[model samples]
Target chain A: MSNLAGWGHYPIVATECLPERGPVDIAGLVSAHPSMIARGHGRAYGDAAIGQPFTLPTLGLNRLRSFDAATGLLRVEAGVSIAEVLATFVPRGYFLAVVPGTKFVTVGGAIAADVHGKNHHRDGGFADSVEAFRLVTPGAETVTCSRTVNKELFAATTGGMGLTGVIVEATLRLRAIETGWLKQQTHIAADLDAAIAALEATAASTYSVAWIDCLARGNALGRSLIYAAEHASAQEFELLSNGRTAFPPARSARLAPPLVAPSWLLNRASVGAFNALYFGRGVARAGAPELVHWDTYFFPLDAIGHWNRIYGRRGFVQHQCVIPLETARGVLAEILDRVARRGSVSFLAVLKQLGPSHGLMSFPMRGYTLAMDFPMTDTLLPFLDEIDALVADAGGRLYLAKDARQSRATFEAGYPGLAAFRELRCHTGADRHFASHLSARLGI
Target chain B: MSDQKTVLILGGSSDIGYATALRYAEGGWRVWLAARDLASAQRNADDVTARSGQPVTVHALDVLQSEKFVDFVAQMPALPDTVISVIGELGDQKRAETDSSYAAMIMRTNFEAPSQLLDIFAGRFQARGTGTIVGVSSVAGDRGRGSNYFYGAAKAGFSQYLSGLRNRMSLAGKVRVVTVKPGFVRTRMTAHLKLPASLTVTPDRVASDIYGAAEENGREVIYVAKRFWLVMTIICLLPEPLFKRLKL
Candidate 1:
């Protein structure tokens, strides 16, 4: 509600008390009310976590009742945040092996979305880390699913959009960390080709990613800075001064003027000028020694706070596509060239090196992932249609989480395992009512 | 168009209402852009679908046509998860002097018909324990002004109704109630009005913000340009005697 930004502000039904503190009978409450959506952390940008009738904020379900430090096993309530897990367990020399960009996400939400991170090429998604979970379905039946028991439900719940059941608690594996530092090397590529070359050459390392300048065109269409890291030992951390709170803390909750600018203000001319300044400001930047802290290295966007407002009132869409390694160079070059020609103003564009897919419903493959922000506008639909065709032609697909305006037709056309997902939804036979609340346009 | 989520817009083709249709279509949501006039709503639907490359269906959903509402609700392939009422008229305070009819129409447009539709949906929402409802009020409802108290009164009444609806739905599961109180919006409705830089908000910005809020339940009663919140704060803090005398 800050400024005149046109955002939908629904009345959040406040459950000031925890689920345990409240009724203590989840089945009774759900049976009495069928339209409830189990929400975790309120982090989902769209409606996957929200349904038509209710949003069940499950972040409050957090409780770490059991942890077997010897086995590297922990059973936690679905609401417990990943940060809390690390805070409690890291001192015991354990952490989530596979984590997304932000530590603010809850374990349940992470599992439901099957979220991945920069280390995805090495570790895969959160589902890979989990062992078992207690699931409560719409029929008010609670079932514990694991690799052995209810195996189909276990796989279905992973990236299942919370349609099948509600997660109460789960057991997951944790990795041992030393000195909380990454033995890292940074390579600065002068142009797109060099960046691609650098990543391709070094992605075999335990940890690897590339941040490319998406606005760069022509000879520099894919200029990038690459980082490959390994878990640092105490000696390496000491040698490089790599451990603990290294970066200057960013200012959070800094109030910016929330004024609505005329539509002309964000048109191509102004955006082009901004792009010119941004693209010109950088050429090739290099190494920053052994990096530390999970926060700074991964979730840089989370540091900025409500960063989406930077696109102003019309908000922005994050479009990500991954083209296979065989076509990565061509697809990336063409995409950047088109963006430059269109004078697209995206302050943040991320490029990551991906590896082969793990299984069914997996988003990653041995390819290059390029993510760029585009201001939501009247022209965006057609513009994206052009981009989608190009990505499709290049054997690439879009990410579902960040999507706002894609048709189900487009999604089915793009994503490889979409048919399998549809069949799963069919077999589940639950009244499919997933809220995108973003736009009623998706044919879901 | 026929496959669209049927929306029964009471006012139908009002600027903000039509703008909402565009927002719906842009997101690939098939829209039933209902208006008082079937032709006007259909035309607006055509315009929105053509522009957004999404589907739009038109329906006659006149507040005056209350008897049709039940049949309308039952006829839908599914009960809509959302309903938006963007009906308002900044009735001149001077008109209240000569005619109660104009004032009543403004009141009913701003408050009554919306309340009736909401009463129906609220029951459905409570019965189902889910659904979202949106009522577009104005910053005019924040504090009554000497300039437009007649219209402001209606909006204020509508705002309170939404607040009550929100309270009722709070325990009724996830029946979301959104009360939009935008400030100076640059739509056809305000074509002739003078607006401050901080007050004016674009249709696209409004649509996107509203879409984001609805998508995420970020806020209720979102002021289009967040600056309006501060502006309203300053206005709210003004001394009573001094505020009443202002030409503004």
Candidate 2:
């Protein structure tokens, strides 16, 4: 037995972690344990990947089954992380169609969360690039799911929070890239409305995301640096690489922060100062279009290993919610105001526009999503509950992958697809065998 | 045929073997993964191939079956530039202490089988006039401990065999032999043991040490994480009476 927690390190649970090796007999394991959840890299920010009793760590199952260079399709075991994929295929001119902020997350976790990238507004969620996946059902039968085969199960499993079954393998359709470089154009926004407008205006770009200053107040409230990027052409890469077109040198060495930061290190005052300096830098470099490495553009935080430790031993909770386009501007402003008023410290704040998602329980919709992390404290949950009420009133939903604490009522209010999802789980007996802290907390 | 360097890894299904295969593959070597479990070896081979964009061939060779050693070497596509033997059995010390059959199995697996297999490869490489051989031993082999002396004794024999092999290969000055002593590796084999954070190193760390040894000539022995060399030195120099008093 080992103590485990999601990426956020909040709500750590003691569970028997069975680190699976090679090919796993899913049926045998399922029958052996009363209940278990599949945990892949534990990159989900909250309790989605953790549960009581047993946690089947899929790290050992990592293997690339096959790759079709001609079609740019790769089949790999669920534990295969995006970092591994990038390391393997980027040099071959292939890249994942959709990638989350961190490349350390496993393909299984990506599908389970129905993760979206900065390109979500243009390319949709990770499910969009998924061709098919092999799921080990709660009944222990391995079933292949695709849009056409096991269609309903496929819909429910993607973004289903791993409750539908254990995703053992997946076939993903990768995009061909000329070079692993992005022509990024940064636009500095003065306030909430301007930031939203900038993101909306850059909708044509293949990728767009904004880093907001959560501590900014009054006229500068929601001030952000919006980055809009498109894959750099071969010619552009040649100019940068002295006529040699190659993927940016394999991921640079990452610096690991101390195991845990003191709780008071990241207080509101410190975060406010950091945000001010960052916003100033963004303003200075605003409008300059530079060819940056994919890692720099998409996964900046990944450069700092164990970055979560900066949040302190108390850990942190990420409140990520998406509001419909119509009410996004107002809700975003109100959220920024509430967070600022509370004087809570959030070191990282990101906002991205999302296109319509297909998965039954997918978090993305045709809306604007704001994600901010707050240090977990006695008052944090109750404070977030109030934010949830506000979001619920505006027909907004919180992302299950990032949710550590939220009232079941608020969850039900946001996800209307819950009824269909629960019905399928009931029919498949997944609800009984496959359960997680997130599922039980949300009463799904 | 391309002049790509080739490496054959015995016990390819083991975590250290698989990691070494990947490390060699990534360094532009065509990897051959041979193990008793062909299915598991093939799966790992596929992963290495995919990751390195190099073709990895898988073969079945049960180390305990000494009769098949000659056939296993002959069956390979070509003589490899390097051969890494990562085969070892960490049999339960308590069980082996009483059961002669179990104790003999541990002894044969950790020492006799691997040494015999390498001896065959050494003869082949001698004829070809170029090759590198790596044997993965352990820090436990430096000195016997009551807790796991049965398994440790076998590894100690294996380590001595590697030392003797290195001396023989040095006479020819064409072939190189490396013995790797990894301390507290965080592998499935040691998952049950509560290893110290400072001492425990990942299989990848051990793999890199093997790679370094193979690439550099005259590197007869290496301790993974490097600090294990100093650690084992002190442990070996300890006064027996005092060393025996403390439970390791």
Candidate 1 residue runs with Cα over 4 Å from true position: A1-25, A242-285, A357-360, A432-444, B1-248
Q: Name the TM-score of candidate 2.
A: 0.95
Q: For residue A99, what is the lDDT in candidate 1?
A: 74
Please give, for residues A1-444, the per-residue lDDT of candidate 2 as tens digits: 778888899988777876575556666787677577899889898888886567877887788988988898899999999998988888888889999999999999999999999999989999999999999888888899999999999999999988888898999999999998898889998898899899989999999999999888899899899999988888877775655446865566479886798888898778889988988888787776778888888789899999999988989999999999899888889989999889889978899899899999999999999999999899998899889988999999999999888888999999989999999999998888887878877889
Error of model 1, residue A188, in angstroms: 1.1
On the 0 to 100 scale, the lDDT of residue A338 in model 2 is 93
Model 1, residue B224: C-alpha shift (Å): 36
lDDT of 2 by residue, B158-178 (tens): 999999998998898699899
Output the chain A TM-score of model 2: 0.97
Output the chain A TM-score of model 1. 0.83
- Model 2 residue pairs with clashes: none
TM-score of chain B of each: 0.89, 0.96
Identify the runs in model 2 with alpha carbons over 4 angstroms from their true place: A1-3, A240-246, A250-256, B239-246
The positional error of residue A36 in candidate 2, measured at the CA in angstroms, is 1.6
lDDT of 2 at A217: 86
